[model samples]
Each structure stands twice: as C-alpha cells, then as structure tokens.
Target: MAGHHSIDYTSITAPYKELCMKGKGLGHLKNARGLSIEPVTGMIYVVEGGNTRIQVFSPEGSHQFILHPKFAKWGRVDLWGICINDGIVYVSDYQGGRIFLYTLDGDIITVFAKGFTTNKKMIIKMQQPMGIAINQKGDIYVCEFGANCILILENDSNNHIQTFHYQSPLSIVLRKDGSFIGSKGNLIYGKKTSAIESNQMIYEGIWATLCWFGDFDSNGNIFMSDMKGHQILIYETSSGRPTLLHIIKMTFVGSPMGIAVDRNGRIICVTDSKLHFFKGNTKAISMYS
Candidate 1:
C-alpha cells in the first residue's frame, strides 16, 4: 500500500456535508463542541456548549432530535465532549466537572465521577472532565485537563477505578490493551503508567495553542483535531515516531474541535458552530472503501 505514494491527495478538500438547523424556529448550533457517531445506527451525536444540549442527526445529515442531560432539568449549562458506545451515549459537563450517561433515545441513566471519594466522603476533586473515550470493556476514560491526568470509570457504575497523571492532558485515546495516548500542552505522548514520570514521549509540537480531541481508525491512524492549527493531524500508529500521514485542512471551520471516524471510514469533525465530514486517502481508509 505504501508503494502507491504517488497519489496526490491535496485534491481531498471540503467536507461532504455541513450540518446546521434549517427549519422555522429550528435553532442553529452556536459554539458547538464535541461529536460522535453510532456505528450501528449511523447516528451523529453532537454536544453544543452554547445551546447546552446534544443534537442527534441521521446518517444522511438530517436533524433528528435533541438530547438534554437530566441535569438540564436542574439548570446545568454548557455540554462539552460526547461519545457513543453500543447503545449508550456519554457526554461531558464541560463546566460542571462531571460526566453523564444516557440512552441513545436520550434517557438519563445516571451521573458520576464528579470527583473522587473514599469511604463515601468526597476527598479528591476533579477540576474538569473534558475529552473522553470508551473501550470495549465498557470502561470510560476521561481527561481531567484542569488536574493534568486521566481517570478510568466503569460504564455500569460510573466509579473511578483508575487514574493516570500527565502534564495538563487535554485529550485522551485508549488502546484495547489498556495503554493510552494523551495530548499534553503541544505534545502527544503514550503512557503505560498512571505516573507522569513514566511517559513514553511519542510526538511533539502537534498544536500551536491547544490539541483538543482525537480518535483511532481501524487502520491504526490517529486523527486529532487541532483547534489552534485549524486542521486534523493524522499519525501512523505503527511508526516509532508516528509518521504524519495527512492533514485534513478545515477551511469552513477554522477552529476544529471534536473528531470521530464512522464505521464507514468517514471522518466527522465539528467546530464552534458547524459539523463537517471527510474521506481521507490513508491506506486503511483506502482499504475501508
């Protein structure tokens, strides 16, 4: 596959579709942040900070419904990150320092990991639960950016089972084997330990200001959204230095935020107000078609 390096991918520009509200009295996205795709249903779940709610869309890019967290019933505001696993959807309470679980139909299951507790007493406080990813085991890994670490929670109980310390980790991605890739400042590093000292430095100088979100595709390509760079940086997971594969230039949404790869190998990204989709020329993406 590497031999076909003559492919000029610069022509791969513009998103296949741009999603926004279109009907009478139908609100548009303002300060929209995180996004995820449900593989089985092909539904896109997006979290809007400005609207303080989640909007679900069909595979064809039509507005389907809105997901308001149960906390919204009590006046919670500003939803940040989002991810869907199985039939369950998880979202981050960007400003509240908490996480909430919900059904695909928007039924609030429970809220948890507000902070750490020992013997039923709140002892450790999590400053923020920003970017999140779930493994096949139903364990959710969250980046506590304000605290410079990541925490693991059981999907069923929402209990904080493990924690890994890094230097101002913003986004996190989990490997099936239990290792993690995190964005700290302008660099991306791999950690097999929860301790900051044992980090295996992978890539540096990834973003100019902030590297917010990332996800790995089936071909081991790591696509990360660089809000400051206004581009999605693709990295090869097999290389020792993780070679740069391609960059999906974000012309429409300059400040790209959350990102996810759909089951069909399409890249889905969102900005402060727009949702964009793209298909790349990566070897894995090529085989995926």
Candidate 2:
C-alpha cells in the first residue's frame, strides 16, 4: 500500500478486452476525459473534451455507438464526470455550467441541474460544474470546480436541496445511507458528525485535481483515483486511511480521472486517452487488508 504495485494484464477478462489495444480506432476519443460503466449492461461510456460527445461501448469493449446532441449549441461542453442510474445517465459539463441528462441510448433528455452562484442573497449564476453522482433515491450531487463547492439537486423538483462549500470540490459520491463522501483540494471530507460536518481528512498532499473519480467497495472502503499521483488509493470507510492499491502506467495516459466499480466489484478507470480495468481479487484484497 505504500509504493507502486504492478498488475498482471494476462489474467484480465472482459467482453472488450481485445479492443483495448492501442490505436484500435476508438472513434472520436481524442482527449477522452471522464468515464462510467453501466452496472446492469456493463456498457462503457466515455466523454471526450475535444469532440464534446459521449461514446458508448458494449460490455465486451466493442463500439456500440456515439452519443451527441443533434444540433447542439452549447459552447465549450467539456464533460468531466458521469454516472448511470436506473435508465438515465448524468453528465457534468465543466464549460457549459450545467448537468445534462441522457437516456441509456444516448438521447439528450434534459438538463438535470444548472450551476449557480450565490452571495449573501443567494442568487444563482452558472459556473464550472464538474463531477456528478446519483444515489439510489435519484438525487444528483454535482461538484462545481469554479465555485469550489458541492450542490445537491432534487430529482423531480430541480431545486437546490443542499450545498456543501469547500476548497475546490472536484468529485462527490452519495453513499447508501443519508451521508456522502467527497474529495476537495487534496482532502477527502465526509459527513462524520451527521448534520454534514467535515471532520475527516482521508489523505493529504494529493494534487488539487487528485480525486477525479471515486466509488465504495462491498467492504465499504472507498477507492479514488489520484490524477497527479498517477495511482488509485483505497481508504477505509470508517477511518479514511489510504492504502495504495494499484498504479496504472500505460501508453498515452498521464492523468487518471473517472472511476467506477461494477457489480462484481471490479475497478474500471478512465484516463485522458485509455480505459483500463482490473480484476477485483487478491490484488485489491492485499492492498486493503
């Protein structure tokens, strides 16, 4: 858990394992950023900054299709974080300052929430909204990088239910309970004291953009990607102490961003260019235990 750990690539198995090869013609994936995997279908969705489109892949890594809004007019729609819940997919646009909702088939449904700025009076203005996650109850939590805070949006009402202000909250995840976990400015904060008090520092000295994606394992531990550190760090849910689990070094990948754990507890990571998956077995167990 302290230093670099290598993974056995030969033992990996998935539907699209062979498609992961370099220069495999993943269309419109230039500068790909955020990614999330569908639990039920095992399909992979990728976001590219330059293309401003969402690419869908089959569970086996075959190209299913590409998702882009027809006649889209939003300028600078750089997708940062994405999540799939029920049959809907949520994507956060950093430059568009809004969260876009789409069907599982990649059709733009609507804007789930819009970014806002508030002073003493609580006026709403659009800002750079990054990382997004949806809980079981369909509540969407969005992290605004420009505003340096997190906002919880009610699913049906479109009203801002709650706001957690911090120093550059890059990503957030809502747990099964009412509480949640988030990474802000190299520190991992959670609702330790109930009533949303941030008393936890999971790990420090991480890059400001360290935690781009995070997910909780079956054991209730949290795994997050450290973009600057170039590795995925696991933290005990109760204590928040980090144990280095896996270090991913591949061609054309410098910063690791979005991460998701499938139903089988396998870890799927998305970097600037590639999508990597690791079997969740002894390798993950040795790091956590």
Candidate 3:
C-alpha cells in the first residue's frame, strides 16, 4: 500500500478549470461557497452565496442551469456545505440552521434536519451548522459550528442519535467503515468511538483562521481547504493518524472555502469568487489508483 512517505509531491500539478465571472446570462459567480460533484452525471454544483442560488456546470466547465431553491423566496439565505448522496442533494443553511433535501431538478423533498433543543428552554440550539455528511445507514452528521460539536440525526427521523464535542468543527467526511474526520481550528481530528483514546488529532499548526471544508479522494486521502491560509492541506489517513502528504498552495484563489475530490480523483476547490481544479501527474496516479 502506498503511504505518504512513498509518494512524490514534486510531480503533483493542479491545473485549474476556470469557473470565474463570465458576465450576465453566462452564469457569473459571486461569493461562491459550497461545492459538490455528481460522479454519475459528471456535473458540478456551486452554491453562490451572493446570488442565493446553486449553479450547475458541465464536465467541461460550461454553465448548464441554476437551482433557485424555494427558500430563496422566503428571504435572505446564507448557504454552505453541499453534498449529493444517492439522488438527493443536501445543502446546509448557515443562517437558518437547517438542512434542505432536494431532487436533482431542484424539487424540495423536505427539510431534512434542523436545530433541535436538548431541553425545553430552547436556549442552546444546534445553531450555525456548516459541513455535512451522510453515513451508510442514511444518518446525517452535521458540524454544528455554534454548538462546537457534530450532531447526528438518525435516518428518516428527527431523533438525535449522538453528539461529539469539538472546538468549532467546520467540515466532516465519513468513511466506508464508519470512521470519520472533521476539521476544527487548525487541526483535523478522527473519531471512531466514544472513548477519548479512539480520537486522534491529525494535523496541527494549520496557520489559518479556520479550516473551511474537506473531502476524501478515491484513495482515502483527505483534502482540507484552509480559508485564511489560502491553501489545501492533503493528508494521508492511516490507523486514525493522518500524515501530511502535500500542501496545495492556492495563491490564485482568494478565501478558499470548499474542497471536493471527484470520482476521477480530480480536486475541485471553491473560493469566495473562483473555482480551482487540480490533477496529479501520470506517475502520481498510481498512488491514488
């Protein structure tokens, strides 16, 4: 098995696919935050915070359509963290503290998850939720930023299964074996059980204001976007301890927020105003493959 020390970072190159301002009627992006790629359809989704809509693009980076959710008509919408599981698209509302489930065509199936009060006081709610992930059982795991914990919502029910405390977790990714990784402050942490010893702190000294979001590659490596640092931190996951593989410098992008690795292993990251794409060299391909 390939490990971090065995891989060569010098050969890895990230040539971006420009998803910038293309003018009116051409899908110009303003304050783009969240990103999710559909592997089956080869389509890309971008959440435009300023426009308050989701934009769909072709595999070749051409603008295709726009998703103006029904909630947009209700008032101001602060959207973040988007994930496509099965056929449903799950999006988090940063301000409303709710997760909305929608069909690929933008039809609202329902409000999947939202802030629930642990007590009758309703004073301490799961507010300011950010990144999200769905487990194999269809359970939802959300990064409740305000509450500083990951809140778990059981499949098809409003019941709370569990909650794991952290220091301002911003992103989350669940593995096939039920293990998960989350970014908090400048560090990435892993949790497989309730015990303290089972938790491993992956990366430290991130040198960023916050770790915005993260995703896993086809080979199980994790990629996190360091918003304030303007870079993507790649980590090799092994035995719950993550070793740094490479630091993808994003000097070309400003305020990087969301990062995603497609089925083809292409890295897609979204900044406040642009989207950047990264691909590895042929020799480096063997590592992920």
Candidate 4:
C-alpha cells in the first residue's frame, strides 16, 4: 500500500438488501455507542450511555438478552466500547477511564486496565475510548478518543503492553500481524513506530468524526462507516484507494457507529437507533466492478 491513498466515491456498493430496523423497548438509549460480535456464540452486543445498558442479539437478529441496565449505580454514565471473548464481555467506561468485565449473563466479574496515563507522566484522560478489538491471541487493542492512541492490554495479566498513538484515533482494527488499521480523519495502516509518522489522508471532502468503525472481510477488504458523510467506505487491502460502497440517510438513532463481519461475510452495523446487517451475495467484488 502507498503512504497515502485517495477515495473514489462513485465505484462502491450501496444500500445492502437485508435491512432490518429493530426497537424492542431499549428505553432511552442516548447513542448506540459501541458494538462487537462474539465469534464463539455468534451473538451481537450493543451499548448505550444514558440508559447505561448492554443489549445482545443472536446472529439471526433475534433479541437474546440485555445486561447492566443499572450500570449508572456503578458510578459510570459514559459507557463505550464493547467486545466479547469466550462468552465474557468487556466494556470501557469513557468517564471512569476503566474497563468493566462481565459474564455473558450480565454479571460483573472484574475490571481491568483502569486509569491509563501517557508518557508525558500526566494521567491520560480518555474522553471516549470507543474502539476495541481482541485478536486470536487474546490481546485487547483499545482506542481512546481523548488520548488519540491505541493501548494494547495483555488479556491475562491485564498489564499495559504498549500504546500506539495517532492523530485523534477514533477506532482501531488489529490485523493478524502486529500492525493495525486506525481511523481518525482517514483510514491508516502501519506498525507502531511507522504508524506515528504515517499520516495519510485516505478520504477527502468528508468530515471524519467518531462515526468511523471498521472490520476486515474474508478477502482482506476493509469496510468502514463514515458517520459525518453518511456513507460506508471500503478499501482494498492491496491498493489503499477507498470506494464509497454505500450511502444511507442518517436517522436520529442511526449514526452508523460500529461495524463487524460474521463468518458468512455479512456486514453488521450499529447505528444510534438500530442495528443494520447487510449480506452481499457477490464474492468480494471490487467497487469499480
């Protein structure tokens, strides 16, 4: 891939066929902030702040259960970032600067990696630690909106291993290698050291905000949701050019925040109001095609 890539909005896919809007009394959700799919159970988890709750759904889009409706009592109002591993769910408290661990059944088990500080020796305040991805090795990569860095936490010891700093990092997706893809104003790819010096604008004429979320597809394509632009962008792994694959009208509850791909290569997105899942039949077609 080049140091910098450009985006061509005309060539990508748009408005996937399988669209489902579900609102089963979620009760005053401030914003559907973060989402993650459990690979083992094939269940989707969603989180919101004002309501201070987590909702789970089966792979088929059935309501499985809800967790932590009383999270406010735990002294946290701004809850963000959700990730599931081996039936255990991990959530980040943006206000508290701590990570809450819970059982799949909604039981608070333990907390880890609380109160992170940077090399400046100042207490690194995380305004919104939104993005989270767990690799097969059980390492957790956490992206903080405030610090603009991705923190690597060892799952077992809960020790801080390393931090990858970028220019206002909104989300991060860890690849099989130590390298990662991060979204700030544009999608970026590099190792930790090179990532710091690597500042490339992948998308132009679009306002990049917290709406950026990404997950890798079977064919190594990277799919992302651009919230401010109201579009879903895809970038080929080999060639970094972005293709504006899809555009959807924004709803009060639909901000296109989080995205993930299932085993079947289906695309699932979490907006402010609803969870949007799109399954394309074509086998990784190029956007220009």
Predicted model with the maximum TM-score: 3
CA lDDT of every candidate: 0.73, 0.67, 0.75, 0.66
Q: How many clashes does each candidate structure show, in the order listed? A: 0, 4, 0, 3
Model 4 bad stretches (over 4 Å): 1-30, 116-127, 186-189, 192-211, 240-253, 283-289
Off by over 4 Å in 1: 1-11, 21-27, 117-122, 193-209, 281-289
RMSD of each: 4.4, 6.0, 4.1, 6.3
After TM-score superposition, the amount by which residue 177's alpha carbon in candidate 1 deviates from its true location, in angstroms, is: 3.0
**Candidate 1 lDDT tens digits, 8-112:** 234457787877742222336777788888879888887887767788888767788887655645455557778888888888875777788889888887876
- Residue 44 deviation, candidate 4, in Å? 1.4
What is the per-residue lDDT of model 4 for residues 39-71, given as tens digits with 9 covering 90 to 100? 887888878664678877888777777786456
> Which candidate has the top score in lDDT?
3
lDDT digits (tens) for residues 159-223 of candidate 2: 77666667777878767775677787577666631454454434444333366778876656676
TM-score of each: 0.83, 0.79, 0.85, 0.76
Least lDDT summed over 10 consecutive residues: which range in candidate 1? 2-11
